[model samples]
Target: MDSSGAGAGAASPNPKCCVSLSAFYNNTIVPCPNCSCNCKGLPGAKCHSEENAGSMLQMPHDPLQEPEDLVRCTDHMCPIRVHWHVKQNYKAYWRVKITVTNLNMVRNYSDWSLVVQHPNLQSVQQIFSFNFQPLKIHGFLNDTGMFWGVRYYNEILMQSGVDGNVQTEMLLSKNTSLFTLHEGWAFPRKISFNGDHCVMPPPDDYPRVPNSSTASKLSLPVLVFISLLPIIIFVGPSHFLDYL
Candidate 1:
């Protein structure tokens, strides 16, 4: 009876058919473990996971490199104004406030960055956003210069249509001996955004440092007293008393 049952031909599972239980549960087809094709799933499909889903759409980017022809300032009549002020002045160091204003009446700017070159810029001690609140900024400064690539957190996006204008401010400390301050304001050697120089008005409008020595000069009374001393010595005491 056993021999007759064997001859009846009950089907056996195929050796080529191999599918994981997880794959079956997830409704995905995984390649057989022994297969040479190494096909994990459908060509365009993937097994979804929380970690993988978060990274699937990521693209590589270099923060230092800017996109080509991102700014067309030459073609547009819009202008970017750069103004700087000396907030504090000392013998060795000074604090400066830099203002960048987008004077573009019609266009909007996004992903903007600024580069300022100064011989005496030592470091950036603090930064402020458009709201006049302290903001964490990313940049570096050395003896030669300083640069900042403004991103979403601190980027200046001037929506000319809505706000009418946009501006950003930065406060920095510099080595005073490296730069010359006329009046109380000092100008940077160059100010640029995305490799294009911004338009700067004449320094005549900036604040000036008062000449401290001018006030220390001899007054008319003091000068007269000094002159009288020499004359008093040349003349006799009786003559000086007579003149008095």
Candidate 2:
């Protein structure tokens, strides 16, 4: 198992650059007031800044003065925060299970998505399906297969209730797979959980061409031509003089 703190732990400061699960899950998406794009002031606009404080950019799909379904967190007992844990004794091709709790008093989530990412591997990206419902106790349930070796962290994105007020989310998972969790996560912004869509961080690395594709393109003649480079370098000038 790869340690979550190794190659996957590297960090970059670009907001567009993806980050690990721990860093990705810890932040919130607030509205960006400086964004001038005319796309209904949604949170995912490309030009939002994190430096300014208390400035709100509305949800990309939400209207400015529309009625919002407001729910208060009376669960002083549970508190308003994201919580999650993974069992150590787990195994499979991808056997990772995580749970998130929405400790709000009387609210259920309308839409939610689970973000699990790793830095080293590409085939293991998994975003669990979201079912629209405000979680009363343990919040909504979402589980993903353990696809790769290890994961660094996990992120839960939420849009709550009928009006999509949003709720506290959590992060959990092995540190290795969690490395690039923040690749596409939006921060310092509030979001409405819409069943129709979920925000995903772009790939930290591009996909590689398959070995079979490369093999099919190269043949015996091509191999011989490439192999002659070294011999040509040693005997080149003599052959060039003869040609001249």
Candidate achieving the largest lDDT: 1
Q: Clashes in each model (backbone N, CA, C under 3 Å)?
A: 4, 38
List runs of model 1 lying over 4 Å from the truth: 1-77, 128-154, 161-185, 200-212, 215-218, 229-243
Model 2 weakest 10-residue run by lDDT: 188-197
Model 1 over residues 54-159: C-alpha lDDT tens digits?
Answer: 3432444344443111111221222344445545555655555555444333223454545565544455555555332222222544433434424555344452
Q: Give all candidates' CA lDDT scores.
A: 0.40, 0.27
How many backbone clashes are present in model 2? 38
Candidate 2 CA-lDDT value? 0.27
Model 1 misses residue 187 by how many Å? 1.4
Q: Kindly list the per-residue Cα lDDT of model 2 for residues 44-94, writing each as its tens digit.
A: 322222232113323332333332322222211221222222212122222
